[model samples]
Target: MIAVALVTGTLLFSPVLATHQVEVRGTAVLSTEEVIEAAQVPLGVPLTRLPRATISERISALAPVADVRFGQSLPHTLIITVTERTMVYQVADRGSFHWVDGEGVDFHQTAEQADGLLGVLDISNERLLRDVATVVTSLGPEVVTMTTKVTADSIDHIVLTLSDGRQINWGSAEKSAEKAAVLPTLLGMKAAWIDVSVPSHPAIK
Candidate 1:
């Protein structure tokens, strides 16, 4: 068999045998349908002709897909596997809610109800929202569990609403670990809001 590279940055396969056989496969953390569709592979085509690198790039375009592996499965079969990131919070737009990954790329099916997921809103800055999403992803599960909504202000601060109707003051993405460390203790106290913006002294009011 002879393989030729195309100027369009794709691969081309010429049959050198009585039968042309190829297999491809990959794993997707959440779903593989999107990955296969993005590859734009025809129903009947040689596997070698498919651009593996280009296909991987297309799969990576998806927000949830963290890592994608593409390879041949057996004969005349293409397979794709994708690893998705964890869901930190669900951001709502208009009436639909979409799941935001750690990278703040919004994807996934929309939900009508808020459910147990935290809601992020009123973000004045895109960078801050992205940083907050990263912080939410890094914090322990309890942080996610306790948080209901995250609102961003011009002061580069985050205002969080807990499930218990208690508000929290999170200064910024910096020192999120330290703030998270005092979460259990703070939740134990009785107050309408907890201010953890100051690393040294976190107050409740």
Candidate 2:
């Protein structure tokens, strides 16, 4: 009976463990105020009873959020950690562009161009979009730094344009990992065009 009463009082009546503040971290494109408002964290509630699952669900509903985690500090604080999506490329529509992540999700739209990320021009189908995204995501920093744009008429004919006006014919998304692994070294060779369509027998001319 003593233990039960202690538990009940600590959980329900204790002011020391009550939520006094909410702290949000790991946000890049989102504002701290935005996450706090969505969480709707009840003030003065006991830390253990903060409805974390529901709060997580609400925050996850935000388009930029890829994942969210919750925790509580012993005295009087609630902690929310978020993992935002990694935007890989941009696709133009009228005057604006949609920011697409590695998973091919169009999460954000803006009129200004994103620096360092490649722009995709001719990808027409959803399947091709995902395929090209996978290929672009697999590429190393060296390759991406050199690349200016990506284009695909079909899923099987993905292409990357270099800053120096060179092309890399990345046939399909099938062997992307292998192709990416070999690209840094391949770019150093004297070649007219590079093809990693078949990574095992890559053609460079």
TM-score of each: 0.74, 0.85
Q: Write the per-residue lDDT of candidate 2 for residues 121-153, one digit (tens) a residue.
A: 553466876887899889988788889888877
Report how far residue 68 has shifted in candidate 1, in Å. Answer: 1.2
Error of 1 at 100 (Å): 1.0
Residue 165 lDDT, candidate 1, scale 0-100 = 88
Best by TM-score: 2
Global lDDT of each candidate = 0.66, 0.85
Which runs of model 1 end up more than 4 angstroms from their true locations?
1-33, 42-49, 109-111, 122-125
Cα miss at 2, model 2 (Å)?
4.7
Model 1: how far residue 66 lies from native, Å? 2.4
After superposition, which runs of candidate 2 have C-alpha atoms over 4 Å from their true positions? Answer: 1-16, 121-125
Give the alpha carbon lDDT tens digit for every residue of 108-143 in model 1: 646574465555664334576577686676667876
TM-score of 2: 0.85
